[model samples]
Target: MNRKHFLSSFIAAATVLPTFKTLANTVESESSSFKIPPYLKQGDTIGITSPAGYITLEQIQPAVLQMQSWGFAIKIGDTIGKRDFTYGGTDEERLTDFQKMLDDPNIKAIMCARGGYGFVRIIDRLDFSTFQKNPKWIIGFSDITVLHCHLAKNYGIASIHSKMCNSFPDDWSKAELVQIETILSIKNALIGERMGYTAPAHPNNRQGKADGILVGGNLSIIETLAGSDSDLTTKNKILFIEDTGEYLYSVDRMLWNLKRSGKLKNLKGLIIGGFKVKPDDAGEEFGKTIYDIVSEKVKEYNYPVAFDFPVGHQRNNFALKCGANHTLTVSETGSVLQSF
Candidate 1:
């Protein structure tokens, strides 16, 4: 038997443990068995792999130099700059490059070059054996949410849902830089405190405290992951969801699906991000607001649902860690989620 088992046995025999205490001890020991990936230390090399969207050579230098400014070396993947159709390369090529990076002992981190689409096709083909054992930070949001959801669900490796390579336009601002830095900070596993926005509250609120594995990403992709093992089960979880340019009814349908399937009913907290809501040049309101849609779907539930956390498809968004434990605070001042 393993040393942990042997020691637990020895302790049980010597101490004559109570039944409830023994069960609690075992549950604690088993549930906490999941591992945290090694924090990114300075000077270690980070690999830039385009697991989804394609990136032009023109788009590469700024992302590279950004990492350089942080005093770390970057190792570009073979398929990073290749443009075979809509992806950085063929599906096979993209998977191969990702596998190569995961296989390399020298690569301490993997950052997606961008996130447009094309990851759901290749998620099942990924070999998570090594990744499960040696977890490293996988960074990016949007289509990159596929990788984040896959890694968090299968390998129990926490990943950041944040900025990608193309997020930084030429006309960048200091606020955007700070947002990206918050992401890179979490990439290094430097989760400090419950840092978030100062927002107002909703009418239907489920107060009190509960904590569990934090998980979520784009609403559409998460809905698609339902029935699959990758779906985030909100038995006790702070579910963070965000999206952009999606019609309000589309959001309503997806949330309705999640509601119908019993996914969003038991959530500990619901974090709605800055929706980037805009009326087009024609000045159409689309008949439904994102807030109304969410409130409608979650009306029956009593969970503390807070909106405007600033962690979705917008600039200056906060970083969130899946598979990490967090405490949620909801009040008139707003909700602040602190990760420990």
Candidate 2:
């Protein structure tokens, strides 16, 4: 070959090789196995931090006492009693407290004290380098869905979606059976028990079976994070969503957003949890039920759809291990979700 021709080919290969290498790295990262943080054992410390809403120390005592009874020590973050309006603390304060817990080697798991708003304000600023290396359980639902989705997208790490400190009953003896069962579900998940839950069949449910990673929380929060760094990748996953106090029209809009974003495509299954819709005003009624809205959006898909699968803001809300592989079975009689 001529010297000029050889040189031109070499330059072209050098440029193309780097691009191919980069694409390969991206694919490898996306297909990597999810990392499950070490489960808790008796006497392990569980740090409690308020990364979202404001909660006084007194408000968390119920949780603290309950966890203590379960044989786990508690490390209360400074933001527990600190408040800045609706937030647990200023953005800086909340971020620092959460970061400390993430980096602490002694803390086996970090349980969010409560969920309201403000996680997104600090999510971008908090560093995960140390936490990524020493992965630990991050527990909460509601607004904490932001963290669950963020960790899944960026690090492929597992976290718990369940009731937080704010949900603990002040008196266990007086607590309802459902509340006690839901709370115990967290302990079972933390201690590495294979968790399974069953929900009664709804007439709207589509019968089928699937096995995939579990991913989802509040529908509104999931929609809010769409297109961001924390947006969920729902393809080939079992997604369960629940929301509280949204109007039927608003729920329809969010479902449309999910459909338009291609979030509802592909295989696996869907679980629709509790949706506490707000009543419409006298003159402005949206004439569609939650079932109708979801069915319309997902009618084209063949994957199974389970309605009222008991994970949400309601009393039946049980602990779910997000980013973990799960088997979903939906039949005419009922639905079963089993974590592996």
TM-score of each: 0.81, 0.91
Best by TM-score: 2
lDDT by residue (10-124, candidate 2, tens digit) is 1111000111111110222433457788788889999999999999999999999999999999999999999999999999999999999989999999999999999999988
Q: What is the Å distance of residue 279 in model 2 from its true position? A: 0.5
lDDT of each: 0.66, 0.85
Q: Report model 2's TM-score to 2 decimal places.
A: 0.91
What would the per-residue lDDT of candidate 1 be over residues 155-178, giving only the tens digit for each residue?
A: 556676767777654433544545
Q: Please identify model 2 stretches exceeding 4 Å from their true place.
A: 1-32
User: Following a full C-alpha superposition, what root-mean-square deviation does model 1 have from the true structure?
Assistant: 10.1
RMSD of each: 10.1, 13.7
